[model samples]
Target: MPTDISRLVHNVNEQGFTALEKTGLRGQQDQGLVSTLISRDLSGSDDLCVSWGRILPGQHHLCHHHPDASEFYVVISGAPLVHLGDTDYRAKPGDGIYIPRGTTHGITNDGDEDVNLVVGVSKPADWQFVADE
Candidate 1:
């Protein structure tokens, strides 16, 4: 029996998985920062990736960008400062921000409480492109 290349297996917990924080990036922090959840190269979806992150007060995620994919962030708790290119915006609960592909963006927790958000990418990311500047 030959498996069709176009057919994908849809299993929630059966895909190739990796934790973002465990990768040793600058954004990986112990107390004030965390990439708590992630789903990458999802079982049946090659074009989409998702991650959930929490940033505590005074913590910041290094500025970076995704050249090959667009991203959307949905704020789930608290409020955070979102930087898109050269502009900054405040995103609170239920707020969403759209970052076009190849645009620079980052987030920081300037409030007193922890900020949690869900980020979705249209395609798998190329970490090499995430710059510090």
Candidate 2:
């Protein structure tokens, strides 16, 4: 997708008001496999971005980092293995995980079903996708 912030301002009044079924899946198909249920670009936000991420069973989100933005995630369903820096945190429903800017982190769904998460990030312009190692 384009990195231009100008194209990310489709708000509620501009046809952005809808649910997950109305939106399409996002993320790299080969590696960062996941679906974005919602996003700031779809909600008319430039500074911050939020979305619901869904990872299928036995799939991994691939370790990566946002060089200029802080990221966070709230587990909505199933167990998501969150890898942060030098440790791994198993996050269940209601668990909130925070990853500082420039920190290495990722998520994995090793359960038998899908893992859903509410993900948020600051400085949407600085979002970057990187490898775990």
Candidate 3:
């Protein structure tokens, strides 16, 4: 059986995935940063907003926070300084950092190599608060 992928696959290259710069997500065109959106719009997944993010040496994503969503940054390459509020982590390849909703976070690459990360954020909950019966 063949499953049609006309809408499911947005970009396919010889490597089988779209290059980060071609996706046009934030940080892609910004100097020293590259990002590719991989969730929600790409997969129709309701639970995540994920992307591939890269930071070149001496570059950083300025500290910021979102009130309604938590986030995770999993290191794919290069050890970089990851900021989670008042704490800082020198995360290496394969390391994962979780940032709670409303907590400030960002990442900086100080080394000579680029820092690659698989970044994910939680989606808005479909459930609503209910008063006790």
lDDT of 2 by residue, 1-133 (tens): 7587545543333342222221113444322233343355454566777766777786676677778789999988998788999899888899988899889887778888778777888864446666554
Please list the residue runs of candidate 2 whose C-alpha ends up more than 4 Å from where it truly belongs after superposition: 1-40
For each candidate, what is the lDDT? 0.68, 0.67, 0.65
RMSD of each: 5.7, 8.4, 8.6
Least well predicted 10-residue stretch by lDDT in candidate 2? 16-25
For candidate 3, write residues 1-133 as lDDT tens digits.
9987753554323213333222123433322443435456556768876666778798766666767788888899999998778888899999988888788776778899988778777872322211110
Taking all chains together, the TM-score of candidate 2 against the true structure is: 0.70
Error of 1 at 28 (Å): 10
lDDT of candidate 3 at residue 56, scale 0 to 100: 78
How many Å off is the CA of 133 in candidate 1?
Answer: 1.8
Error in Å for residue 12 of model 1? 12
Query: What TM-scores do the predictions have?
Result: 0.69, 0.70, 0.70
Q: Model 2 clash pairs?
A: none
